[model samples]
Target: MNGLSPSRRRARELVEPQHWVSGATESVAGLCQFVLLLRLGATLMLVVAAVLIEPDPRTLLLGTLVAGTVTAAELAVLVRHPVAVVRWPVFVLVELVAGAAIAGLMEGGPVFFSFSCGSAAVFGVAAGLRAWPVWVVQTVAAYAVVAWIIRADDVPATLAVYLTGVPTLYVLVGLASATARAAVIRHVNLARSALEAIERSAVAAERTRVARELHDSVEKTLRGLSFAATSLPQAVQQRPQLAAELARTVAEGARTAADEARELLGMLRADDLDASLAQAIERACQEWAVRTGLRADTDLADVEAALPVRHEVLRIVREALGNVARHSGAAHAWIDLVREGSTLRLTIRDDGHGFTVPGDLNHLSAAGHYGVVGMAERARQIGGRLRVFSGDDLGAVGGTQVVLWAPAGAMAPMSDRVRT
Candidate 1:
């Protein structure tokens, strides 16, 4: 606890030497500081005892040598115990007996020996055993020895000898140690809080990344299959002569299931959005135009202008277009992407017979319902709103119009801009 001085406590919390660099977990600098402090305490005691109390030079030198040897022995104990900290009863006992003996032999003040035992006990507890009984014993042992020495009429010194000089110093040392122990508690709490915050941020970030990936790859694949289902049925209904061809195309889905399932599972677990939005958008426009003979024009800017935006935007466009191709009897559809002030706007309007939006989109399109529902939710998630405008009075061929405007600024910037 004596280690908890403002400077020493701060050092332990902030500047505790980290020797983990260069594959060293050993406390090289800390050990040096520890030894340094112990030697310094011993040196201080010898100098003070010699100057203040005028002890025999022989006794002074003997105390210095013995304390120094004790300091070295304590260091060896640390090496032996390492992390499995012990009570260090031997160190405390040595300090109490040797220090009291030195005082008795010196034929001088009781305070000198008291300070030595108090200093040793403070460090000894650093071997662990912060229990109150241990603290009480250490304090009482040092207190009783110094009191008894001074109380004996033979040893000659003022009552101030025991009262002011040695007891006061020991009391200050005890206070300092208590302070140190409190600081360690505070430091541990702070480190724990900081670590927990980092962990939570990492978890939330990973979840968002995972959600975006699922929306992009696996969701796109599912939509594609749904579109195929729509296209195959229509082909079969329209061209009776090509019914066999349409049936065979549908049958091929079974042949492809093995590879498709593997890819979907991989997409679910591994986050890899390698396919660019530019490629995805271009492909969507081309496919719809080629299949339906509908004039589909896409106004796509720098596709990666918004990477997080891309996942939802692509889904919205693909979903809206797919809906038009299925329900609305439309010949042409325009998918427009433009940045309007702070908002990035997307408009998918088809020149087909548009009907009232059902109370629930799922109820109307259960066979292939995920696309529209997911698109609507994705729009809301990106701080954007998706509005379906299709009543009766827009044009001669009334059709569904979906408007999705996501803030250009809020979107996660292109991959190159976000530093890992």
Candidate 2:
């Protein structure tokens, strides 16, 4: 309403609309080809009819030559500019005017009327939905001009009906078919977009699940193996029995890592979280102690959490202990799990050489240390907060302390939790 008329805008859209035109062209290719061939066949039959009927050979011959010339020019324009086919009214107007002139020259003959009828059918179909009115006006005016030239009484009643009814039906059918094709194309596009979105979502969810599995199993075993390997040479010179134990722990850790990886390969299809947080933490602590010859003191309190939260907490504890064994070089570590009213807090403290805590936790990934970042993501997944304090915050004797605060009802919406 503000700009071009709706009909004009639709005409432009049909010509070269975004992705629609390209797709529509392909969709209607066969139909357009069929219509074109049908038009050409009708033209051939009209030409044959003209030659067969003999009343004023000179005018009929001249009319035949003119019709052929017009048809050829129209076909050439159609082939060269397919996008401009919706604007067939302009080309068609010229065609019908020339067609009427040829009919007038030939008198009220069968050949001229037959040619007009054939061309009208072709123009009606070519006009499609956008410019059918143009086709109608061109057809009516051409018929009127010929009727006036030859006199109405001389023109057959059947010729008038044939000229009007055939073209109207063809144009209406063309409009209906074109509209239906566009609707079908739009539906196909929507279905394709939805399928792609679902596929992308599935891929993202799988990746998150895989990262969690690695943190829980393979990462923990590898950390224990690394500690045992680092401690083996020193223990060999000081205590032969301790060196032998470290070797055995390394071998056991490798076997456990392999077993965990095998389990993870099959775990891609499963979402079962059956591990208990307290027991998993205790087991991880015991394993770290054996490998690093460190003391792990655990103070666990009874807490209730959803299966997902419990599994995530277990992974967090495992990751924390793995950090202690590999990077912390802590002689002793303490894990505390306690329930306070509606909240549950789990803390892992290491009495080791702690680094300066970074303000932006994302820097952990940049520095090639993903343990803390992975822990943070795990906490976030369960609508929990993970905070790590190290260096000066641990007083004159510096150490690392990671605390996770989670609501008792783990299924509570993350939006409901206060963000700091």
Candidate 3:
């Protein structure tokens, strides 16, 4: 720390220490407003001081009239934002000249002294105006006024101190003017960016709303058609007597197709998990119970976690276990969901007469196990892999553990955490 105390040092700097930059900027604004008012007030005092000091009544009356006129004009400018806010520099030079004239005529004899009062007004005008080239003109004119004042009068050196030293005020004014301009520009840019962001968000929300409506109207119709198609074979197998019912399925399929076509038009318009392993061996207990007609115990906890992957996954679980139920003569089924780092591992193991891993991927399709095929396709599309394990002689674990490993992309992690 400096030798001086912090509070004392700050008081020395004109502005307080804390939040110095922000406080100074605000002060500048208040100072401008105060100084404009002060000029108006001080002009009245100068008029009175001139009348008291001067012996000539005519000179006093003339001085008072001039002071009163200038006061009224500056006051109008103080209250109003003029169309010629751009012509602020020109007006500032006029005021400085007028100030010099007033000072020269004073009987108290402070020639060029009134310049300080009006200089602040000029500097303030420069800061408040946004028009380009205005500040440059005012700055140049101020230097000219300083030079003129220094040369025009014959004064004692100490009284003429401003002639040499006033560039400090000019430099301070320039810095303040530049800073205020930059702050205003930044504010404008931020407002524009915020507006653009809001519009994009609103557009995206509208597109999603439209997509959901389309899915409800078209997707439901298409799904109904698929269910009808799958039902035909079963219907015929049961009711060979009703031949006309076959034609009804065709009409249903046409309506579904038309509905989907309309839905595709909607989607074209707008643009923008699993679990793991577990007690791997104990699942055999469930398989043993089902096969031997004993009570099966299944304490599986995977039904909820897999819901977001949607219905295809549920179909897959049922189909895989159904296979075990039909051929493997399995007793119990335990579904295990585990998280392994970023991947979700789902292991469905059953204690049964484990068979060889099916060689043909299309074999499940042939057996009308669309659920398994669909699930595999869905997993593949979602960056996941699926495998089946079986056989008693070669494998260490006797039962089948169909393990699925999926690369849960960025969106999936938060979803998994929420669902879990």
* Number of the top-ranking candidate, with TM-score as the measure: 1
In terms of lDDT, the best-performing candidate is 2
Cα error, residue 109 of model 2, in Å, equals 6.5
Off by over 4 Å in 1: 1-39, 42-45, 48-56, 79-82, 86-165, 233-420
Candidate 2: 10-residue stretch with minimal lDDT: 411-420
Task: Give the candidate order by descending lDDT.
Answer: 2, 1, 3
Lowest lDDT sum, 10 consecutive residues, model 1, at: 18-27
Give the CA lDDT, 0 to 100, for residue 170 in model 1. 45
Give each model's clash number.
5, 0, 13
1-420 per-residue lDDT for model 1 (tens digits): 364766444334322332112211133223323643655575666567566666456666665565566556656655665321223344456656656565565533433453464543344334323334444555565566556656665555566464435544444554555455445544555766788798998678657857665655465555655666677766777876566665664566444444345533543443335755545666666766887778887665433435566656765776687678878899888876655667878788988878766666555456545556667778887888777778564656477788888867533333422110
Candidate 1 similarity to native, TM-score: 0.45
lDDT of 2 at 6: 79
CA lDDT, every model vs. true structure: 0.57, 0.67, 0.51
Model 3 C-alpha lDDT per residue in residues 1-420, reported as the tens digit of each score: 288776445433423222223333333434444555665566567656766776775655555456556656655664463322334455566665665565456432322333343444445444453422444554565566566666777767885685555544544554565465446445545666788798898678657645653554456556766776677777777876543465485576576568446534532331111332122212333443455563344333222333224222333454466556656677666665545666666666777778665675558766544435555665674467777777954376576767677643222332333110
Comparing 1 and 3 on TM-score, the stronger one: 1
The C-alpha stretches of model 2 lying farther than 4 A from their native spots are 1-12, 15-22, 55-128, 149-420
lDDT of 2 at 315: 68
